[model samples]
Target: METQARLIVDVARLDEDGERYQGELSLALLDLGASEVFAPKGALAYDLFAQALGTELLVRGTLSLPLNCICVRCGGEFQKVVQDRDFVTSIEISEATDFLDLTDEVREAIILDLPSYPVCSDTCKGLCMTCGKNLNKEICACQKAGSDRRWATLEGL
Candidate 1:
């Protein structure tokens, strides 16, 4: 799911009326296939500024939702709560600030904030490869074999 929001605003007279544009926006976190994870309940607030150099926009927001993925250890379906992360992205927008460029910048910020891999938990007990059992759910009867040949001498004695 996507836990990020993108805002596009006119920087003309931004400093004077930026607060007017600042608002809470709701967004949906989608999966890689663009499927919504849960109901749309994310928010973003931003302040826009019309600087002499260029138009500067201050974007900050949070996305709260349960991220669903397969458990790394148990290989089970699980949902992980992803906390809202505040992100600020600065963009130099001119008369030529097109949708594509703004989207690229927003997409980059979200990708940077996302975790590389989602895990069920910090101490998740994975599955047993020998029997294809979820160690977290049930104990497997696989035995550990002794490797040292010298230990065999003691058995004969």
Candidate 2:
């Protein structure tokens, strides 16, 4: 199915009282076109659970994405699988339009859940301030100096 068609629900097929529809959606359906948080390699999987309530559609589900992120401190590359299980949103459909597309909603949910500052690990030592070397991988000579010239004047106080 076409990307847009895959994310659309035919409201005419659902009962007015409320009916549940379950399905799996590919990441391509929720593609944001371009994003910093989404990786280009791994496939994202979305487990969808939607309910029809009269003219409204209630969507709730989980989505998993393998993300390629950069360490905020060390500037190193790393991969992490992120999941959003609390995804929930609602859309209104009119009698004239029997379809509701969830592409934008799903895309927003994934983006909102991304970490503001991503790190490779909890103990990442970051970089040596003086020589700008990754401290996590090796010790630097500047570290032994143990004193910063910027703070030299403070010693007198």
Candidate 3:
């Protein structure tokens, strides 16, 4: 089934004690073009939970995203799966507003959780400084240069 990204909670249906709703949603991260940290391979799977609390709505969920990332050191493409379980946010509803849209909130949460520096692997050798060749795949023939002259004065001490 096609899942809508927006979660509109009806305030009128909620009781004095509040009501809880749960469902699974498929978010089109790719279509949205949300961020550059990680590119979405397809629809992200998310388990959503919401509770209407008077004028406020408490939203919580867990999501797993299949992402394509570029290594910061070597600039190589790699795949990564980002899973967030403790995702939570809240929305306020007024007398005029009947429903609250949680789509933007969800998208923001995903973007904020992305890694600043993505690595292909822990043992990634990165690129050769002199030849600009990927060190992880092959060793470059470029000779290793000596230490910088600015740092040479400190090396004696």
- Judged by TM-score, which candidate is best? 2
Question: Tens digits of per-residue lDDT for model 3 on 1-157?
Answer: 5646555566656555655554434554225464565677766566766666666677777866778889998999999987788888877866676677665666677776677789999999999888899988877666233335446768877
* Candidate 2 backbone clash number: 0
**What Cα-based lDDT does every candidate model obtain?**
0.47, 0.72, 0.70
| Per-candidate alpha-carbon RMSD to the true structure | 6.9, 4.4, 5.0
Cα lDDT of candidate 3 equals: 0.70
Clashing pairs in model 3? none
Better by TM-score, candidate 2 or 1: 2
Better of 1 and 3 by lDDT: 3
Each prediction's TM-score against the native? Answer: 0.53, 0.70, 0.66
Tens-digit lDDT string for candidate 1 (49-78): 323244555545543333456655666666
Candidate 3 Cα RMSD (Å):
5.0
Model 1's C-alpha root-mean-square deviation from the true structure amounts to 6.9
> Model 2, stretches more than 4 Å misplaced?
1-5, 15-40, 94-97, 147-157
